[model samples]
Target: MFMRAGLTIGEFSQITHLSVKMLRRYHEVGLLEPDRVDESTGYRYYSTAQVPNAQVIHRFRELDMPVREIKAILATPEPEARSALISEHLRRLERQLDTTRAAVTSLRRLLGPASPPLQVELRTSAAQSTAAVQAMVDQEEILRWYDGAMTELDAALADACLSQSGPPGGLYDNALFTHERGSATVYVPVTATAPAIGRVRPFVVPAAELAVTVHHGPHDDIDVTYGALGTYVAEHALAVAGPVRETYLVGPPDTADESAWRTEIGWPVFRTGIRVSG
Candidate 1:
């Protein structure tokens, strides 16, 4: 009987580098059924031809591919359909890898010695008319929404032949940070407001006094600047209830080099007569 069955379960496990336990689980899941079974002892056996399939499953599992997805890939007869499924999983893995790298970079910066104190200033901004896009958005989706909104604003300005008077900016409600969802606005200041287009519309940006600090480099560590600025406001100024404003003086839209980026983070405040400390 052993001579008739191609390989015992243990033999197949050794050749495929898969554990006997995993093979059993795969068999139970109908992922890889045995080629033959002994009627008397109910022993499982696999053919030598199944070695390649087991190895392929092992490689896919190493890449963290789901068993279900692997099954789908195997079941699909069309080469293109199978390739598409694998390609999509690879893309998802790439996105996860990118997020992990960014988190690692941020962690390194945070664990290093404290940097010099942030230089904060108090300034008054006057009311200005602009073309803007506003929406209620989730925190996780803000970046995507911002990119789309800014692109539309730029095209609308170009179509109307209007020149930007200042850098593009955003106003984010406090609830956005506290509750992870809230009203957000992205705007480009222009000499004259352009006609409403899609989510973009002619609007006025209200004036307010702000305690501002410039955050240099990529936005990955921008929260550090926001924290420092908030500390200064709590100590020296009267904090007002309003949306937080960010001015993208030099950003991805301006340069691909993140080190060259400059963002101005402003907290709404009422100026106290106290002088700014370095």
Candidate 2:
């Protein structure tokens, strides 16, 4: 009987602390190919020298790195290049973890008792001249759409040498929240008549009487604040005609800490109702 040149698949699995199934998957994906294969018996064998590589693959897998990305990392020969690949994946994992943490915190608060009293104010906003961009966007893509739109508006404002009158604001159409697809308009108030360029054009944001509340921290739990405000509006019969208005007081480009973020949510209402005073 001829002995194998290296460790058999079972021995290799023991040495690498990988399951037989996992090892086979690694082989199948060309991630950690076996050192040799016996053609007659169709047996797979891995060399002892492959232990380190197997361990690295295991660690990356534990980190939830995608197999394709792991393959890219392993294929790169340069130390710096490999480090960059790993760093990129680590950053992505961090972002995912952050989102998870935020969700957990948000869920706990939502599941618990009713939130503290929120001061809803009624204020009449005067009609304003503005440079704005409007587009139909999905709910999931609203954040990305907002970022790009704001960037464009900023560039247009710069090109036109116009100074912003106030913090940037957005008008979210009802269809957006109702059907999850609708028109979204992002704008910056400008002092004078601004030239219409590209998607950024001059328009008038109609005035409205709004019942408003400030949402603190990240938007992960903003729906809670929205719910509270909505309840207050419905209970008082203050809800009237208009899409929701958001005034981004302290947002990105201003602060990276979500805890420090402040957004003002406004529900349109009739100015005549004298129920709750601000």
Best by TM-score: 1
Q: On a 0 to 1 TM-score scale, where does candidate 1 land against the true structure?
A: 0.80
lDDT of 1 by residue, 22-117 (tens): 999999988888899889998999999899889989999999999999999889999999999999999778767766776786778778988887
Residue-pair clashes per prediction, in order, are 0, 0
Cα deviation in Å at residue 255, candidate 1? 2.2
* Candidate 1 error regions (>4 Å): 1-18, 30-60, 68-95
Residue 159 lDDT in model 1? 86
User: Each candidate's TM vs. the true structure?
Assistant: 0.80, 0.77
lDDT of each: 0.89, 0.88
